[model samples]
Target: MEQNILDKANEWLTPTFDQDTQDRIKNMLAHAPKELEESFYKNLEFGTGGMRGIMGVGTNRINKYTLGKNTQGLSDYLKKSFPNETLKVVIAYDCRHNSDTLAKVVADVFSANGIHVYLFSEMRPTPELSFALKHLNCHAGIVLTASHNPPEYNGYKVYWQDGGQLVPPQDGEIIERIESLKYEDIQFQANENLIEYIDAAIDAAFAKSTIENCSFNTPTLAKENLKIVYTSLHGTSIKAIPGVLAQAGYTDVNIVKEQETPNGDFPTVKSPNPEEPEALTMALALADNIEADIVIGTDPDSDRLGVAVRDTHGKMILLNGNQTMVIMTAFLLEQWKRAGKIDGKQFIGSTIVSTPMMLELASAYDVECKVGLTGFKWIAKFIKDFPELKFIGGGEESFGFMVGDAVRDKDAVGACLLVCEIAAQAKASGSTLYQELINLYVDHGFYKEHLISLTKKGMDGLKEIDQMMINLRENPVSEIDGQRVVCIEDYKNSTAKNMFTGEITPISIPKSNVLIYYLEDGSKICARPSGTEPKIKFYFSVNAPLNRAEDFETVSQELDVKIKNIIAAMQLN
Candidate 1:
């Protein structure tokens, strides 16, 4: 055993920690030296977002002690930021194991520190927590969920009064407060008077607000014809999505019973992430059984959404994040224009890794389109920066979408409703959702995107990822897939270099670890490390002109082959 790890593990045995935690530490020390080292060698980092890790009893894990310390830091920062005003925070949790317990611990810390706490009486989706922050006029909010990680993983995400994740100096300032504190500094005792339980009222209001963001009027005939299947993947959406769909006038909606229950284990899927096909297996099976018009699934926390639509051959096919974004963005803009709502002040947003078709759509509609960094927090920042403009909609390529500025994060509840409405309207117009996607490709040029994520686990994986980024920066590629590399955008350095012109332009965003290569043939490949996961992701995007819907197959295959060749040339496989 290393001396430092042994010393850190010894701290947990103090009288300050409970007997159960001390005993767990003792057990690890006696039998599991490797586990002890992994748990105590370093503290779990509270990154720009928040803390996420496997649940266990260690400074490097998501446990009662770690969560308490984080909450205490947040409480301290809140008091410092608004010394003259009364501080109030809202806390919500998902169905992850121990999430409910962690939420109460967070509330207890806040209440103990003289801050009013509005704790949900039941688990709720993460977006609802974001909405509650604004609706309740609170100072900040926290949600206990890991989004789509594996069963053993859990997280705590903090949001500000503006209903978005913390940004800039705030995130850094909060981290400084957290780092300055020790376990003994956390206030674990609860003040019952300052903690209030919230339920039904907030749910009703959030559901109503989500429904109001719908762009199209309810199509009674279409709603009756569109058969939909939905699964919450054993998370919080089971409490609200079906009700929202019903409110939107959809009569035929089926829920995947096997996954409808809010079970922390997520028994039916290997992972709770809707971005993966296996996560939607139960919903897809149910859709096939009922011959449903569309199948929709949300991640454990219900902020991200995945959809499967019947193709031209009447077989169900899942739509990637980019395709969903294009379809939803186009539908919203077209509806806004048809209703004479598209003034010059309306704008849409997309991340750099997302397909560029959004730019073309915004230009064609004569509206502004802004590109941000990877996270929806950046999109939220965009909305905050340009309050003069109306934010119509926006999304990324990771199955996350935000419609309207009502909620300042990626909202799966509202997204599910809007997507269902789109499907219904398409059905009424004598088409399928898949066909509508084809029409989008025909109108806007055909765009195809593929993402490959390579997971490298444990501490060594971190070093390997860093080395990969370093090598890419030091030895930049000049060509790929038989095409000259016309441009290289190093987001870390905030510069874009033109390979031919030798001109360097500034990228108007904060420094992040991202690299994008643009080929002369109009192909783009972006390399970025996941902020919330132990993985590095490569995003490939290629495009071609679609003359007609009949040639969809050929064009798609060509683009797929092109993506394969590009990946091979880059040796990503």
Candidate 2:
């Protein structure tokens, strides 16, 4: 069996794979049986998120073989989904390693299979692909992006006829078709004439929808410079962001020069996640030097966004994902109300683990806010299900936010443009965006969320994780860090238990292995195992209304201390 694996690996040692990938595979085969099995295990299954893995020349990696197989699966699924169909599928790629080549391979596979392919002439943002999927009314779509993952990874996201990620039975059906064939079964070429280049048409559609989605109807905030700083994080938003801001009439736009050029390796940041302050280090430095009013950064795919603002001390302060979502949603809701954009039937959505203040804020304004399972796909599902009811926006604590219904997926480029617009609008109102956020804290109460990931690698690691979950279920904790757990939501069992009455209620949302403990003090702790990575994540949320601005740091310190104590008590380092 080992020899068979080696032989299979050796076969890909051909000229099809680049020398670097070929050499890496050769090196992996020489010494690491454990690594080899992990690398080749059953081919990284492509589901709704499509495909993702560390880039390499293995059946398990996101190389040409995997990318081609996925495209073939999509082609087969598309044909079955729309029989007698002249299918059109739009394709886009990000700035991750092998993203462009993998996208071309996907285009080739689809076009070669007799599907009309609309390929981006160059690299584009992930949300633009989503917009193209809808604009062209494509039968399907594919975006080659690992999202906010580290440098070693890349991904392929499959969009369905509804311009959303494949969900439910369709997701399973596509996976089955992809598994039915080997690498050799994939089609990788096409009549080039059938593959049309799609650039200006889709770009125009995206820009038009984006501008239309801007809620700055009154433009009361345009009189000020706003002094905004934004970085693409060497991803896909370099050109369109500045262009959108310039078009939005903001003259004081500053871009981070060192990280201006798109590079897959992401030389500047250790990781390209805006949720982490370290990722925005360069942008913050630039903002301080330029004394910009606000700073924002996007990930490799530009679907998620991060922002920073100056504190009263005149120092750049990074906002967490919760803070970013809260501000955006609040700002949009206010603008919509002022412009009478609401029909009272309009709604928004957010994940369950996101800051709860959004649901309250939406309710206060007569806007419907529903909680869905994690991932933008679920949020998109809501958007597709309710065509009559408008979807104003949706976001998660993981730094994903999408505004308007222009695109089903998260749109960082759109959000980036809107953030600057919000800043300008606020400056015109004779206040800063930070002051607006503080006002929100005063209105909806303050919230701070902390995420802790514990990685467990290897097959044995999976078992250990399962055992941990089982233990947590069977021997449930009554308290953590001396705080009573008033309620426990077990997503695996789909039940919410009330500690006082011993009553159990079903969770209407999707069933997952996530558990949320709602404390009496309104703080929440959520434990969820990652579906893609070898890790379990714990989300800690704590907040206390500040009596005065002078006591903000004191309250923040208390929350941090509470989180540290809880983690320490749980023995989760």
Candidate 3:
């Protein structure tokens, strides 16, 4: 056993920690040195976003002590940032195990620091927390959720006053404050008078805002005629989605009863992530049995949603994040054009790693598509940065979307309503949602994207992922499947180099650890490490002209082959 690890373990046995925590530490020290080393090797990082880890008692785990330290630091920062004013913050949690208890601990720390706390009475969707804080005029907000991580994992995400995740200076500033504090410095005693439990009022307001923003003149008959099957995947969406649908006049919605209730274990699926096809198995089965028009499933926190619509052959086919994003952005653009709102003061937001079709679609509408770094927080920052331009909506190549600016995060509840509207209107016009997608490709270009994520587990895994990125940067690829690489965008260095001419141009975005290769044929490959998870992701996008709707499948297959060839040539397989 390392002396430093033992010393860290000994510090936890003191009276600063509770008896149960102390007992667990002693047991790990005596019987499970390896586990203890993993737990105490380092402090769980308050990364660019926030902290996430497997729940346990350690400096490197998601527990009362780790989260308490975060809250206390945030409390100190909030007071410093807003002096001479009453500071307020709202707190919400998802269905993950121990999330409720962890959230209360966070709230108590805030209240004990003389900050007023508005804690949710029960589990709520993550997006609602974003909305509640902004609606209640609070300075900050926190949500206890890991989004779609496995049963053992939980996380804490901080939101600023604009209802978006903390960005640039704020994230760095908060992390600094957190690192300067000790675990014993956290104030866990609750000030009951400063803490208030809230529900109903915020829920009603969020539902109403969702309906208003996403309804988009969707007729009552059209909504009634659409047959929809939805599953919460045993998470927090159940508390919000169904009611939002009813309020939006989507009464014919059917819930997958087996997965309707919130369960921390998420026993029905291997993982609770909507991005995985297996996560929506029960919902798809129900949709098939009922001959449904659409199937929707949201992750545990309800921040991201997966949609499966009946294809041209009446088969339930799942749409990837890029396809859904293009479909939704196109719909919103058309709506804006019809309403005469595209007066050149409107822009849509997307990430650099998303499909390039968004740029083309935005051009067709004579609006600018502001491309930023990954994450919806950048989109929210865009809205705040340019007050003159109206934000229609935006999404990334994840199972997340935001409709309007009502919620400054990827809002699954609002996105569900918007997607349902698109489906109902398509059905009313004698076209399925999938068919409408084909039409979109015909109008724009047929773009297909594929993502490959490689998970690396513990300490060594982080070093390996970092080395992989370093190798890609040092030894750049010049060709992909015989296609010449034209441009390379290294976001970390904020430089875009033209491979053919060797001319470099500056990238006007925040520095991030992302590298992108642009081929002469318009194929793009991006390598980025996941900020929230222990995974390195490779995103591949290819496009072809869709001159006719009848040739959609053939062109799509060609693009798929191109991506596969690129992957193989790069030895990524």
* Model 2 steric clash pairs: 221-425
**Candidate 3 global CA lDDT score:** 0.92
Per-model TM-score versus the true fold: 0.98, 0.93, 0.98
**How many clashing pairs in candidate 3?**
0
lDDT of 3 at 338: 98
Instruction: Tell me the whole-model lDDT of each prediction, alpha carbons only.
Output: 0.91, 0.81, 0.92
Residue 95 Cα positional deviation in candidate 2, in Å, after optimal superposition: 1.2
Please write out the lDDT profile of model 1 over residues 228-248, one tens digit for every residue.
999999999998899888887
Per candidate, the number of residue pairs that clash is 0, 1, 0
Model 2: how far residue 566 lies from native, Å: 2.1
Model 3, 1-573: lDDT tens digits are 778888888999999999999999999988998899889888888553467898999888999999999899899999899999999999999999999999999999999999999999999999999999999999999999988888999999999999999998898899899999988899998998999999999999999898889888988899999999999999999999999999888889999999998999999999998899999899998998989999999999998989999876789988999888988999999999999889999999999989999999999999999999888999999999999999999899998899989899999999999999999999999888899899989988888999999999887888899999999999998988999999999999999999999999999999999999999999999999998889999999998999999998789889889999999998989
Candidate 1: clashing pairs of residues: none
| CA lDDT for candidate 2 | 0.81
Tens digits of per-residue lDDT, candidate 2, 275-324, equal 88998888888888878889889888888889898776767898888887
Candidate 3 runs further than 4 Å off:
1-4, 47-49
Please state every model's RMSD to the true fold in angstroms: 1.3, 2.8, 1.2
Error of 2 at 71 (Å): 1.4
